[model samples]
Target: MSRTLPALRVTALAACLLTGAVLTHPALAATRAAAPSPAQQKLDRLADQFYVARAKFDPLLYATANGDSRYDDQIGMAISPVVRAKQFAQYHDQLRQLHMIARAQLPEKARLNYDILEFEINSQLDLEHFPEHLLPLNHFENVPSVLANYASGTGSQPLTTPAQYRAYLSRLNQLPAWIDQAIVNMKEGIRVGVVQPKAIVMKMLPQFQQLRSSTPEASIFYTPIKNLPAQFSAKDKEELTAAYRQAVERIGPALDSLCQFLESDYMAAARASSGYGDLPNGAAWYKARIKNNTNLALTPQQVHELGLKEVARIQRQLAELGPKLGYTGPANQLPQWVAAQDKFKPFHTEQEVLDAYRKIYATVDAKLPNYFSLLPKARLDIQLEPELTRATASDHYTPVAADGSHPGVFWAVVNDPAKYSNVGMTSLLLHEGVPGHHLHAALLKELPLPDFRKFYTEHPSAAAYTEGWALYCETLGREFGFYDDPAPYYGHLNDELLRAVRLVVDTGMHAMGWSREKAVAYAMQVLGYSEARATNQIERYMVWPGQALAYKVGALKILELRAKAQKALGPKFSYPKFHAVVMGDGTLPLPILEAQVDKWIASQK
Candidate 1:
């Protein structure tokens, strides 16, 4: 939060672009001034080169997901000291080059691009101060689990062509090296007293154990072999099959070795304290994370206070809804009664759950055009999360591939239908399906934006913009008439309350020294979450500090901006146009989005 782009750069770039040269004849100049300024031309060239550099710097996993095949053969490990130092140097060099540009001399859009690039480079630099690489893999972000998904042929990494097939094998061959580097980094973290919480480690070891297979066919690495194209030559198929067996043989032992290290050695060293603040200079680190995730200059206490108010307000609303739902008791106990009701937990089979989500998608898909003028062209499909990971997985959306070879996927983790409440199903579909991530992410690909903007996954400040937009989309159900039903309305409120609870508990765990148990207790007591659900939620916040805060903070900002626009424009305010403004620039920091909204409001006048 302390470091920011210089104001001089902003002013200088705009001035140089707008007033650098004066035409002798104003009339002739007006018609002939269609060409961009010299600063814009330079900025355009820099943007092109930046994307090239970004491609080389991207993690191999993200590169594969982005459909950039250039890095398929390279399992780029940034965990090692040598690699991390190089990454730091490269980021610094990019930052230096960005500083050279007269940001103020550029056009509006170009200047915004410059600011985004600067934020990304600076954020990467900021990350180097912490030992994040040491505690790299968690239950939430286990690389092996990700690799298994990809290898199992259900993920984004395409294995259609022979070249793509070989690329997959090459990546599998490099898994051992990635595992080795992670072990080294974990040891370094232990040496320096930075590690994941023991709770996460306990959960993670079982995942690795599940990945270990005795036979090649039984192994996840053998997934591609099962789906080999019939068009391949017999000799090529034989060679690939042998190679895959070898890779599986190698990967199996590596998985066991890594699991052993984590269970026996690293587990002992894992941090008992959940907060990042417990580490060296952790307070400042967590504050930077808050800024990074929220893209706002808010202190933890300020966020905490805001969260408390929101919780109280939502609880009041829940109380108001209770009598309407035939429950006249206290609001806090409403969720318990709702959970116990046979009507809310109506799904008796997994198929019923799938059918319910599909119906929700159909319902929302038909209503989207009423609220949004700009809709995604890409298709979205609903699928059940794989049984292997569904127990831990939440309902999530995977963006469509940049090439459109794959559609956006909305995966519902229907671990047990009898236990899964259908109350939040409508809100979940809206957030994860038609008008939430599927719409926002797929539309970004169709935008006339830079390739870097369209494809990258680990962009510096995207969570709040994207996730907040999804959360905001949840509120749209009311406008579309989905919340007229009491159950769905209660679900919407529960979802909103969940985000509010995140802000309180996320900051509480990281900044205010709340214990894991306290955070879990607060979640269960206030949100009516089950013990296991509360534990998982708290542990997620523990591992990834400040990320949960993005949802509430981002949604609030969007809501606030929409209110301001409606107030300013009054009769001229258009909901569709306002939505277009928010999403027009693709994913942006909330501050940039607010500015865009303000500009749209002025145009309406």
Candidate 2:
């Protein structure tokens, strides 16, 4: 089998054809056939070059993640200047041309290629425009913080060999510069009005200071060194032990410095202001970010309004379930019932957490045939988020490749499995696993589109279509005879409520001038999230503002579109055909998706 696009970043390459003057000459057309245009020939050659490029490329994302020699010499560091510049220019150049082709009536393959290319281009451009660097190190994904966990040698990177251990040492040593640059960039954001809210920065102090711990053994990053590889020569192990200590000395001090600066300087300097739009050039920056992310011309107010409608609709459902779950007496009692449910209580152990996720997958799968025309070829598994990452992460999906070599993963943060509630598992499973990302992405990767088209771009249609569809799935519990248990069905709506709350809270943070505290408070009280989980989600929105908006906004639009398609086609609509069309040619812009569906509907007649 051919290699798949490695990490699935949006990407594209274009082939343009030109017209010859002779082709435009009436006399030539009347008397003789036209000769080939050089531009047309060059464009064809460019297309061929693109194909060759695709064949040769398997993006080294895999090697980077594993710390393979493919980049063993390269330091596995983040926040570098050179890396960001090339990323910006390469994507900028590709998109400028790709957009040119998109405006043309090109062949279906060419349009698909350009569409995918546009997505890749946008992903790169998103960084430069957003003040992401301002709050570069969230408690969750900041590289310096994560390295301490990776240094523990329990993460994805291989630390088995003595040389591999040293390579990690080298990566650890590079942290001071990375953090220095990150601080510098963030300051730039400050001057320009790009800044993270002080609320998140306050939460960050404990995380970084935790790494500044007095003993290397006490540091989270020092765990790997605490245990040496048994196979290493004693002398080599001794040297590695020294090296690991030295690296941590370097990293530990940096973390401590970060802690000191964060406690004394950074948080003070951070804006009490919440939105990026509060910064200089803020509105334009926010607009560009929204457009790039949602792939539509949408205002914050528009999205804010969208969030409200979804919240109300979901609240109505929650009211209906409150009685079944012992929220008897009144509709208002539902929130009280939701808050008090023992079933909504988190797992007390990791096994319980995994078992809960497993139950969700099994229960859903048992009823899968009623909803899906496609399913992933690979199995799904649940695991604890790596200790290195769990502190910073919630839940996430890692999709399998086209070859079905990797199983789709539903990684829950099992460190605090007691914080893992069963109430949200069903809807969360739908979003991350079957009929959500895995099914949509795996099938798209397997489709007959061009290499770039298949893997690069995630069409607005897919996320809005698939996620919204899954959110809709949570509502379909009774239809499948699953949510009749009341608990699981409540779990399904709890998941749906989370997405709906994302709508309100995301908009509240970025658009309505809601403080981070206000966002979390609303989430805790109204959305029924625990203080710890609410803190994680709220901080995530602060670090990356508009992204949270996409989930509910996209999902709601898809549900609306599906209703439209169902109405237009009536009995003629085939669920299988509807799905095939949605998944067939890779991701699509929502407008194009609607058009594609409209065309498909016409074709049926």
Candidate 3:
């Protein structure tokens, strides 16, 4: 996800107030009558320390994305043993300090912040037992792939200023060393029997090859130099361009080296098995992933069983809806029938595809106020995915800049517009644009929460709540009047079925010993995905085990909470208030969110 925040300038006195430090300044002492409790002060100090330390020691992008520019000139070694040790030490120390705080003494808002910070700290500490750094690069998310986007001048990394350009060049100069470290970590993974599946390794090879260009000018890393602002002087442009070209030239060999290593040494060591269960301590690792992604104590078998029931439930609906759309096919064949329909593939150009999404946005915007009192200040913009990453990337949402400098972007992957089905367009817009990710994410940033909470959605701990809320938003299409047509309604069901299918197939492969081919075949049968598409989705699950499960698991919890609220409040129930409560405090863990919802329900009574 792309992350950028508005600049928050904190003066020394303001910083003291933020961290709950004692105010002895006469100007402030005269105005203040009561001081915060000691426990509250301790909690605030610990939270502030952890937040700043994370920005410094964690990935540089985490800081840069949040408008913290302290690490802009350095690409820190996130996967190195030394860095990992330091990160673990920091988390342990912070946890110790947090334990000393008296949670009962804090007010409701401070307690909420404490709970979130505690969850974040514990989540980091959980990784200390695992060797995640050893298996770092994946087809879905890797350093080189992300850095290429930063260099392309279109991603979260800013290239508007000369200093930004210089910082990027510094990062490019560091590329070789980072690639060398990844190789070292992968070698360790091989020794420890924690290698990626061969299928995933094969996917990474092509990505590295894509990053290598014949010359600096043709490289993605040269993009910023080419697009240098007109305000830059001739001398500034010349020096920066020369520096960028040299940096890009240096990066080519590094990419080629890594690509060659993966092709040869790494490929030979790659595991034939697809699931995490096949690795050393694989089952336990998969369990950790499930807990991290879903924030639930559900076992793999339970999740798998739940998925089976959900799939059956959604399939029954599809079977019933098929006849209305003039399809008399069996339930399993519904997706294929829908795919074959000419009416679904209406767009012939990218602009036509974009316009369709915009039209849906307009339709949803008019009806939003009826159901949502809490709306994002940031406007949503729809754009086609960039060519460099479009092939591997799905349509997704990028967060809005906190300062509203840039609108939230819904990137539609329209590689071949003629082949892009219009069936799911309305549901997709709702999920990724208006009331889905864009609304949830932008509103979180705008909340009067700690900086850590404002930026918390990027972490794995918040995945369930954020993704669940987005999936739930798709169901809102019915209330918004976008699903009156049978086609659009089918789209909603199709999307829901895909999430349900993920729960089953993800657990089946990682926990039940299902092969990659078996999982792909299951998706193709149920979701009517092409062989290539099914393989892509399955491989994604293989690389990021249990992540796909978040959508279904999270959505079901929200839906259940809403049902409880409706039953209890009856006539007093309000969609606007319920939505506001769900979204008002930014992203939260599932249990905390449920507790918040229950509290709101009681308040109405």
Candidate 4:
């Protein structure tokens, strides 16, 4: 990836050719107006330099994160702690430079440049808090585990050619060292309190063991190698067949070694306490995480309270829908109804499930113009989750590339038809498909932001605002008259209630110090979620604290803003206009999003 331009900087070129702030600025030189100042040119060059660096980083980061290996050569980019530290300093320095230049020199549309700088700085700063390299592999999210899935010729890892096949072998070779370092970091985490919960570690045991069992061809990840490209020369095919066998040899043993260490050593000493607060200074660190993710100053208690209030509000809405369907009693019966409804049961086959979701997409796409004045340029596709990782994955959406080379993918984890609920698909589609994440993320990608702002979004990509908007889209089915069936309508609310339960249970687990049993029990009892589902979710929260809280917190904030916008504008408010205004800004901090809508409303008035 190119980090530098030949001589002419990217920002300078933009300023000179695009802005014409340089040569004869039609007006500037005509009025004898101040020619482009020397400082302006310098700032332009600097901005261009940043863009060039960003352009280089964008595709590489994308390739890697998306599971592509175009930049495998850069895999050791952060290998050394000293180099990592230097990278952190470099990030801070760049952020400082942008802060000064943005506040003083850049134009208004370029505000994203500064915002992205802040995000990058925060990311780099946060990296120093834990020595994650010490523990390169964890059960919850590790390269070995992920690569096993990737090598299955599913997900983002390409396996179309012999070269790509070799790439996988090479990456597999790197796993042992990465996992070794990961164990060390995890040990450090244990020393300092950053370790994963025993429950999550338990789940990983089965997974790594699954990796350990293999005839090379029998392994789940080896499926693609077994089905090598038909066009490959016989020699290449034979060589690839051998490569797969070789991969399983190293990969299988490495996984077994790591699993043994984690199971015998790490899990044995794992914390009895589950919350991030239990770690050393974990309380303060969690608070930082809360701030980082929600972009709100809310205490856990406040967020917890918000969840309770939202639960009540949503249950009431669900009750209204239930009565209309001639199913009455308490409103809370819907999740149970969601589970018990025969019509809502899983499809007999995977294609049935895919078709079901695809129909939802088509239906929603047809009606999108009814509710949205703006639409994303990127397309969305429905695909099964990668074989390597499907068991753990629920449905998820990946954003389309900013350049539109790829379409947004809505991955359905159809590993078990038994657990799939007919009631949940509506909410899943509304949130993960069109008019939800696909729209939100793709639009954010395409927005005319700085190269930095355009691509890099981590946990705090403003989940509440983004995810909240998606949740709100779930409710919009009612607004657009698309919830033609009571089951689908309730399906949407069932998921809403599920999220509400998360508010209670996530806070229950991390902030309130509830044990896994207590958390799972409360979920099953109050929310009607099954024990298995509850166990998985509880373990998930155990591994990644404070993440589940973001969904409800984010959804409520968006709902709250929508109400304010509607009430403030009263008769003048238009749903389409309101949606456009809210979504027009990609992902803003909750308060910043509030200000964004407030400004939009004031202008409308």
| Maximum-lDDT candidate | 3
553: Cα error in model 3, Å: 0.8
Candidate ordering by TM-score (highest first): 3, 1, 4, 2
If candidate 1 were superposed on the true structure by all CA atoms, what would the RMSD be?
7.0
The TM-score values for the models, in the order shown, are: 0.91, 0.78, 0.92, 0.84
Ranking 1 against 2 by lDDT, winner: 1
Tens digits of per-residue lDDT, candidate 1, 362-394, equal 888877766665666777888888766776777
The better candidate by TM-score, 3 or 4, is 3
**lDDT tens digits by residue: candidate 2, 1-605:** 11111111111110011011001112322443235344333333444444333222212232332112334324432344555555556556655555444335554444444554555446446557554556567665566655564564434345677776776777677777767777677667667666667877877777776667678667665676777777789899788778767777777666656677777767777888766657776676666666655656788888777767877886788788777777676664465566665667766888887887787678777665545444444566666677655766877765444433344566776665554556667767776766666666655545444444444333322344445544555555655676777777877766777777776777677667788788888887767667877888888876665666666666666666667777887776655556555655556656656666676766667
Q: Which candidate has the highest TM-score of all? A: 3
Clashing pairs in 3: none
Tens digit per residue, CA lDDT, model 4, 1-605: 11211211122222222221111123322332245454445455555555444333332333444323454323342434565566566667666775566345544334434554465456446646655344344455655666666565544455677876777767666666665556666667677666666767777777777777756667765666777888999999888777777766766666677778877988887767767666666666666666666666668787778778877887787778877666666766756665776666757888888999988888888777656555665678898887666766567776665434346788898876765677778778889887888877766665444444444333354566667777878888886576777877877776887788777776776777778899888778767778987777777777666667777777777788878877887777766666666665556667766776777777768
**Over 4 Å off, model 4:** 1-63, 66-84, 123-127, 130-138, 161-170, 213-224, 232-248, 325-334, 402-406, 570-572
For model 3, the local distance difference test gives 0.82
lDDT of 2 at 192: 66
Worst 10 residues of 3 by lDDT: 1-10
Superposition TM-score, candidate 2 onto the true structure: 0.78
